[model samples]
Target: MIAKSPLRVLVAPNAFKGTFSAFEVASAMAAGVRRALPEAQITCLPLADGGDGFRATLVAAGGGRTSRHRASGPLLEPVWARVGWLPGRSGETAVIELASVAGLARIARPSPHTAATASTRGLGELIRAGLRGGPAEILVGIGGSASTDGGAGLARALGYRLLRADGCEIPEGGLGLRQLHRIESDRVDRRLAGVRVLAASDVTNRLLGRRGAAAVYGPQKGADRATVAGLEAGLHRLAEVAGRDLGTSGLEARPGAGAAGGTGFGLLAFCGARLFPGADLVANACGLDGALAQADLVLTGEGRFDRETVPKHCAIVSIAQRAAPNGPGSPGAL
Candidate 1:
C-alpha cells in the first residue's frame, strides 16, 4: 500500500476461531482506521473458508439475499437453514452451507452411534428448495456435516432408491449401507437436468481407506472403532454400487470425494457436482479479485497466523496471496 492520503483500504478477515466473526473483526478494524485516518476510504468484506459464517460472507460480498428453508436435520428432525440467493437467470446461483442445516455443531448429547446413524437428507432437501428457484447453479459448502453415510441420505432424499436384497428400501445412515444391494434412480428430480452444482471444500481425502472420509472424519463425529470400520465398509459398498449402476467407477478415489463424511462423493456420484477449494470459491463468488485491483491497502486477520494458515486454505491467506501475485510471504502487499 502507498503512503498516500485518502488511501483505499480493503478489510477482509476470517473468524477469530472462538472469539469473533470476520464481520466483527472488520468492523472494529474499520472503526479504528476511521479514528486514526478520517480521510481514508475503507471497505469491509468478511470471509470464511466455506464453513462457519459462509452464508453471511458470500451474500454480503456478492450483493445477495438470504431466505430460510425448512429441512431435516442430521438426526432427522425439522430445522430451518438459511440459504444465500444471488442474482442469476431464474436463479443465477444459490449458496448454502451444510453446517447450518445438518452439522455436528447443532447436535447436542451426541450418542456413541451418532456417526453411524446421522444423515445428510436435510442437505439434499436444501438443494431441492434452491432448485425450486430455477437457478442455473447451486454452490454448496459441504463442511461440518454430522453424518458418515457417504451421502446415501442425500441421494435418498433427492428421490434415488437404495434397495436391499429382498427388494426392500435400505435404511438411511452409514450402518444401513451394509444392507444396500443396489441403487435405483428412476425417480430423481428432473429439474436437476441442466443445473450445475459446485461443492466448496478443500479436503483431499478419498471416499475409502486409511485417509478416507470414514477413517479420518468418523472419529470426530463420535464414532468408535467398530463404528468407524462399519462406516468405512458402508462407504466402500456405496462406491461399488454407484460404480456398477451409475457408472461412476473409481470416483471414490477422487480428491475431496470423502469430504463432509463422504458427502463429497455423494455429490459427485448423485448430483455430478464439482469440488473446489473453499477459499478460491469464496474469492471468486465475492469478486475479491476486483476488490484487490482497486485497493491500495489490504488487511486480513484470524485467531492465529502460523505455518498452517496458508496450507489450510483459509480465506485470510487467500486475500493475502491475491494481493501479491509475485510470491512467498508477500501477502502483506499487492
Candidate 2:
C-alpha cells in the first residue's frame, strides 16, 4: 500500500536583504518542502518584517493585486512603486510599502556617508491613490526608507503644511527640517480621515535618542557625524512642535518609534495610528493562525537566524510558533 503523504506545511520568511528577497526565499524553501513530500500540500507566505520588497510579498502571499504609481524618490526623481491590494469588489483596501518610492536604493551613498534627501511624498501619493478607491483604511508598511524628514513629505502629499517660523513653506527632504517651525493642517485632505491609518514597522527606536532614528539609522542613510547631530536636532524640534500642537506627551520612545526615518512619529502625531511589527501585521492579514491550525508540522527559517532575529527580525515566526497549540510551544520545536 502507498504510504500516506506528509501533512501540509507553511513557508514564511522575511527578505534576506543582499542575498534573497522574501519571495525568493519562500520559493526556495517551498522547493525543498516539495522535494521532501511531493504529495503534501505546501503554502508559501513570503513575509516582510516591514522592510524591502514588502508590496510584492504581500501581493503574492495573500493573492493581492498590484498597481503602479509614480512617486518622488530620495533624489527628487520620479520612481516607480507598486501598491498591493486584496482583490475584491469592496471599495478599496491597500497595502503600501515605503521602500517602493523612498527606499535606500534611491540613496546615492551608504549610511553615515549618503544623503538623506529622499522624501516620503511618494508614499503619500500612493496612499492617496488607495483613498481614491474609497477604501476604509490604508495599511502603510514603513521600512527601508531613505528620508529623515519625519514624514514631512508624506504630510505634504496629504495636504498638511510644514512651514518655517517665518511662515514660509519648508522644502522637501531632511534639510528642510532645519527651517520648520509651524505646522498647518486646516487644508489637510479630509479624505484621509475616511480611512483609518495603520503603520507596519519592526523597529522600536523612538523619534530621538541614542537609539533614535537619526543616531541609530542616520549612518545608514549617508549621514555623517555632523549630519546625524544636525538631523537629531531637527527631529527633536519636530517632536517638540508636534507635542506642543497636539497637547500630549506623545510617544517618542514607543516601540517601533524609529521606523521609516521617524515617519513613525509623524504618523502617530497626525494619523493616530497604532504600530506593530511588520510581520505580525502581515501575518494577521494572511490568516497565519488559520493555516497553522490546520498543520501538523511546520517549517520556518530566515537568512541568518540569530539572537537578534528572534526579538527583532524573526519575531513573527516566534510568535506563530508560540501561539500554535502544541504542548511544547517554542520556535525550536518547529
Candidate that would win on lDDT: 1
> What is the per-residue lDDT of model 2 for residues 1-334, given as tens digits with 9 covering 90 to 100?
9987667677766777657887888789889878878877887766677777677766776687888887777666888888788665654568888887778866655664334566778888888877777776677888888888787788888888888988888877776778778788888788887677888887777888898888878887788888888888777877777777655356776777678788887777777777877777767766777766656556665666655455563535544655555565322224
Q: Write down the lDDT that model 1 would get.
A: 0.85
- What are the models' TM-scores? 0.88, 0.87
Global fold similarity of model 1 (TM-score): 0.88
Q: Model 2 misses residue 43 by how many Å?
A: 3.1
Residue 217 in candidate 2 has what lDDT?
Answer: 81
Q: Which portions of model 2 miss their true places by more than 4 Å?
A: 1-8, 34-41, 87-91, 111-113, 246-249, 294-297, 304-307, 313-325, 329-334
Q: Specify the poorest-scoring 10-residue window by lDDT in model 1.
A: 325-334
Alpha carbon lDDT of each predicted model? 0.85, 0.74
Candidate 2, after superposition: displacement of residue 194 in Å?
1.7
| Residue 316, model 2, lDDT | 53
lDDT of 1 by residue, 1-334 (tens): 8766677888887777546878899899899889988998998878787677777788887789988989999999999888888886565788989888888887886665788899999989998888888888999988778899998988988899999999998887898998999999999988887799998875667899998998888888899899999999999999999999999998999998998999999999999999888888888877888887767778878777775355666787677667778344232442
